[model samples]
Target: MKNILIVGGSKGIGNAILLQQLEQNKVYNISRNAPEVTHDNLVHFSLNVLEDALPEIESIDTIIYCPGSINLKPINSLSIDDFRNDFEINVIGAVKVIQKYLATLKKGTNPSIVLFSTVAAKLGMPFHASIATAKAGVEGLVKSLGAELASAVRINAIAPTITDTTLAAGILRNDRMKENMVERHPMKGYLQATEVAGMADFLISDKAKSISGQVFEMDYGIVSFKI
Candidate 1:
């Protein structure tokens, strides 16, 4: 069975991907807090991606970095630590995972690495300067690593906008905010957590062998046809 490690898989999109893949692979979810999933193939560990490099790594088949923080603020109001923290979690976190699992990945038949970014990293949006800027760094990190890890491991990222995760509580909590977000997309709805899991599965599967060093926007057409 393929062995996969997911950093920050206790909640949001990460948990969905971990659960979806459990049917076929041995899944290890690294999180500081306990997750609410149980299965023979699923192993949950208390891990801090920011303070740790990855744990219990074996011949890793695929690894996904899911630690991200959203700090939305205007340029003038943004603090130095805000930018630093964003990079620490979103950019540095991915690097730590790759470095820790690089050797193990090389031992796999065809290893894959996935990171999460934001649609704001590609498309422009207001009040997204801080998180957007950090996720933009994430976009660059994946591409560069993809090239360096080729043949053995493939690196890719998923950038989504306005998904229905707890991370989007502020935006989806109120009627005005919800309606405003829906109106921006032609589909008039947000991308679901499962939709992203499907994308992640594709990226790590044989069908995506030719895909790497790119950010896939599963944004409900947020980048296309700005109506």
Candidate 2:
């Protein structure tokens, strides 16, 4: 079984990935809060990726950085700190985790890394300036690191459209809003955490051994089609 380290695996898409991997791999979760479920193959580390020092693990085959922000607001209403905070959460934190575990990862079997972006980075949505800028940085990191770590390791990112998670609770808070969101997508639906989790699972597996430095958009056609 692979040894996987998932930063911010306490909730939402992260938690879904954590649960899915528990049956097959040993998972190390680092987040501010503990995950609600307990499993023999699971271990928890309580710390902030940006504020606290990450714990040491002897070996790790995959690193999945799941911390992100969705601070949507008009440019006039957004502050510099808003951009800073979002960048730190969406990009810097992933950098910190990857740097900390690079050595151990290099030594592991079929080592790979996965980071998250958002469709907002490419879709040009209103009120998404801060997050779009930040997730754009994430995409850059994936491309650069995919080349830098070419032989030693592999890296990629997932860019999902508005997922039904607490992070997006503000947007999908009402039935009317939810319907609007569904209608916005050509697929007529938004994403479930499980579907994103499945993509994460594929990126880190031997099945994706040939893939790296790419951003997979789970956008439900929002970014891919006009219909």
Candidate 3:
């Protein structure tokens, strides 16, 4: 069994991943809030990735940074603080966690790091400037750090389109809104939180050992097709 450290594992994709892996892996859930469910193999730690320091972990086989922000606004309407906040949560927070646990991760068995990105980073979407900018930086981190730690660890990211989660409740509230979202993607379905979490699970598993520095676009064809 491996030891996994997931920042922002309290809810949404992170929470789903925590639940899926806790049965076999020793998982640490660090976030401002604790997970809704608890297990023997699951440990909870309160943390604010943008503000607080992480607790020392013994050995981390996989590192998943899940803290993200969605401040969708036109470029002209968005203030500098909005960009700063997004960067702090989506980029700097992940950097802090990775830097803090780099030593422990290097000591693990085929260690890997998983980060979350957004399809908007690749596909141009109106009112997505803040999140897209932040996630773009995350993609860069995966590429640069993946190379820097190639011998010691693997790092990758998942860029999913609008997913069904509390964080996205505002966007998927009514059938009209949901339909509009589904219509945007060639695949006429919403991206589930579990599906994204499953990919994260795979990256950390031995099956994906050969993969690194890659950004998996789980965007349901948003970046590929116009239909």
Candidate 4:
């Protein structure tokens, strides 16, 4: 079985990914809160991605960085600190964690790294300036690092649009709001946390050994086509 490290695996897509891989993999979850789901193979590290030190572990076959922010505000309303906070959490935090564990990842079997982005990074959503800018940096990190570490490790990213998660509770709280989001996607359905988790599973598996430096947009057609 592989040893999988999931940053921010306590909730949302990260939690789902932790659960998905528990049956056959040794999973390490690093986040501020403890994970809701318990498994024999799961190890939870209670720490903030931005501040705390990661547990000393080696031979990580895969890492899925799932921590993100969804601060939707118009560009004019966004403060300088807002942009900085988003970049710190979404980009800097991931980079720091990965840098710390890169050696361990190199020693693992077909090691792969997965990071998250947003459809807004490419689609130019009106009120997504902060997060889009941050995730766009994440996308760039995936490509540059994917190439830099190509011989030993594979790095990639997933860009999803308006996923149904606690982080997005404000957007999907009401029927009207939910309907508006669904209608924006050609598929007429938004992404679920578990579905995104499944995609993460695929990316790190042997099936995706040849795939790296790419951002897979799981936007339900919101950023790709018109309904």
Candidate 5:
């Protein structure tokens, strides 16, 4: 079994990916908090990607950074710190972790790294100023790194719209809110955590060996047609 290291693998899409990963490999989970789930194949490691460098990541075959923030406030309401915080966890934090584990990733068999972004980066929704700016940076990072890390490592990202995760509970708290969100897409619903995670698992698997530098969209038509 391959050794996979997933940062922030304790919840939501991260946790869903972890569950799928556990079915096939030894998974090292790096996160600030413990996952609500338990597993015998899991090795949990307390790691705040923004706080410290990864430990002995040289042994990890793949590393997926799930660090991100959803700051849905308007541009005027958002402070400079809001954008700063978004970029820190969304882009900078992921970079720091990847750099720390560069050697290990290079050591693995066709090492792959996955990062998360949001559909707002490309869709340009209101109240997404702070996060859209930050996730935009993440997109740039993924493209640049994918070019630089080629042959030895593959890099990709997924950008989804308003996934049904705790991070956006406020947006889906009631029927009115949920209905408004669902209507935004032709599919008329937000992505389930399991659904997005399944997409992620497919990317990391050997089946996607030739895939790299692509930003996969799982937005349920939010990024395109609504008809």
Candidate 6:
């Protein structure tokens, strides 16, 4: 079984990926809080990716960085620190985890890395300036590192539209809000963590061995179509 390290795997899409991978692979989860479930193949690390030092693991075949921010606000209401905090969470944290585990990852079987982005980075949406800018940086990193790590390791990013998670609780707080969100997407629905997790599973598996440095949009047609 492959040894997978998932940063911020305690909640939302990260937690969903953690649960699914445990059925087949050994999963190492690092997040501020512990996961709700446990299994023989699961390992949990409690710490902040930005404020705390990451734990060491000897073998890691796949690394999935899932920490992100949803700091939505009008440009006039946004502060410089808003941009800085979002960038640090969405981009710098991923960089830290990758750099820390680069050596061990290089020695593993079919080593690969996955990072999370957002459709806001591609679809021009109001009140998304901070997060969009940050996730955009993540896309750039995926492209550059996909080339730099070519032949040694593979890297990619997933850009999902508004997902049904606590991170988006503010937007989908009520039935009317939820209905509006569904109507906004051409698919007439938003994303579930499981669907995004499935994509993450594919991107890290041998099935996608030939893919790297790409951003797959799980936007449910929000970014892909006008209708």
CA lDDT of every candidate: 0.85, 0.94, 0.91, 0.91, 0.86, 0.95
Residue-wise lDDT of candidate 1 within 94-133, one digit each (tens)? Answer: 8877787788888886789999999898888887888998
* Model 5, C-alpha of 207: deviation from truth (Å): 1.2
Point out where model 3 deviates above 4 Å: none
Write candidate 6's Cα lDDT for 1-227 as tens digits: 99999998999999999999998999999999999998999999999999998998999999999999888889999999999999999899999999999999999999999999999999999999999999999999999999999999999999999999888899889999999999999999999999999999999999999999899999879999985
For lDDT, candidate 2 versus 3, the one ahead is 2
Worst 10 residues of 4 by lDDT: 50-59
Q: Is candidate 1 or candidate 2 better by TM-score?
A: 2
Worst 10 residues of 6 by lDDT: 218-227
Distance from true location, Cα of 42 in model 5, Å: 1.0
Question: For residues 97-180, could you state the per-residue lDDT of candidate 3 as single tens digits?
Answer: 899999999999999999999999998889999999999999999999989999999999999888899999999999999999
Per-model C-alpha RMSD: 1.3, 0.6, 0.8, 0.9, 1.2, 0.7
Model 2 agreement with the true structure over 4-87: per-residue lDDT tens digits: 999989999999999999999999999999999999999999988899988989989999999998887899999999999999
**So what's the TM-score on candidate 4?**
0.98
lDDT at position 51, candidate 5? 80
Error of model 1, residue 8, in angstroms: 0.8
Model 5 residue-pair collision total = 1
Clashing pairs in 5: 58-104
Q: Enumerate clash totals for all models, in the order shown.
A: 0, 0, 0, 0, 1, 0
